[model samples]
Target: MRSGARAVLALGANVGHRAQTLHAAVEALGATDGITVEAVSTIVETAPVGAVPDQPDFLNAVVLVRTDLDPHALLAAAHAVEAGLGLDRSTKVPDGPRPIDVDVIAVGDLGDDVVLDEDGLVLPHPRAHERDFVLGPWAELDPDAVLPGAYGGRVVDLLTRLHHGEGPA
Candidate 1:
């Protein structure tokens, strides 16, 4: 394994033991070979957002991890964790309800933000800077968190901007 690099993950679930599923995800990530669960933000319940909005509210939280795994490998682990906890993306509506959804918010150390664009993974999570579900919990977990990339800055500031209606559309 490589030396540990930091990564932020956002987890949400609106179906099947939402809180428990998020907790289990934290435990699972902690147990993964190359990942160490660092801190977890308080879970927040919020109305569903995105294409499919007529769904149950979602319980969302952020998990910070220090990992030796590369970005893609870490994402694979997240997907595996989601699958193990009952999320079947193949059968769900796009942006619809699911038992668990794990998203990579950002990857890199405290000051250095990594940028990547691939088929299924995009670092700094293209829209993380805009989603309160992601930003709120992230700000709570890491007070000094910085999101690197376009539309990126201090997490707190981003969240403030989002709340002030200053975020991207």
Candidate 2:
């Protein structure tokens, strides 16, 4: 059997039962073949980012998973989990509120600074370092987590810097 690669995922939901949607997404991910959820961060509620004004606040969390699937397959699995939870990206406005949102933030060490602009995927989630919703929960799950590449730094440090107005705008 091939060794599983470690990947980080960010999850959020602002519509319906937010908490339940997030939890269910995690569970669904674990149920997929070749994907094993290793660690999950505590859920945090935060105001929407990039949403239309007056949009509902979101329930957000981060998860670490081990998967034998390659990066592309892993991404597809993440999207599948989102779709299963009622996230219809095709019809939803970008950054809009949703039943569930699952993003592949990074994929192993290869994800460090590696830029891939495929049709529907991007690695290292270009703006992850700038978002408290992503970094905060990530730090909780892996204090030693480093973004790697040009955005190099520990997750906790990134979150601290972002909190203090030092991170990217």
Candidate 3:
């Protein structure tokens, strides 16, 4: 682990004390070793997006962090934060309601070309640019944010394209 690699994390919740859980999750993340919380986007509430959709709205936010941990370690740290906040992954259904969700949005800068396609992790979050829940808050925190990948682009531009139904076909 080094000292200043930037990473983006997305937090969400729809069960229990949603806002409180998110806040705690952020704090816990900041407290973790090899990670430093930088900025957090204003939490936004939105309807769930996925196959299992009969659930309550979710409060989501984006977190900017300076981390020394590698991608997989960062992911493990995120999962730890999720579990500490009452998210039982084994019992949780995909897209189902949960107390917390910590998503690894992106690691490293656009020029770095940080791409990862390992067994349990994918860099730049394959669907980040397409989901407003992630982009909206991300744009709020970083207007110039550029998602790096085959389906990637400027955060604000992607959000605009999504609203216009102009996503890649």
What TM-score would each prediction reach against the true structure?
0.91, 0.93, 0.92
Candidate 1 TM-score over all chains jointly: 0.91
Per-residue lDDT of candidate 2, residues 1-169 (tens digit): 4478889999999999999999899999999998999999999999988747578999999999999998888888988998899988789888887899989888888755575657457677888889899998888888888876567568888888888988663
Name the better of 1 and 2 by TM-score: 2
Candidate numbers, best lDDT first, in rank order = 3, 1, 2
lDDT of each: 0.87, 0.86, 0.89
For 27-76, candidate 1 gives per-residue lDDT tens digits of 99999999999899999999998899889999999999999898889988
**Which regions of candidate 3 fall more than 4 Å away from where they truly are?**
110-119
Poorest stretch of ten by lDDT in candidate 2: 111-120
Query: Which is superior by TM-score, 1 or 3?
Result: 3
* Better by lDDT, candidate 3 or 1: 3
lDDT of 3 at 76: 92
Candidate 2 colliding pairs: none
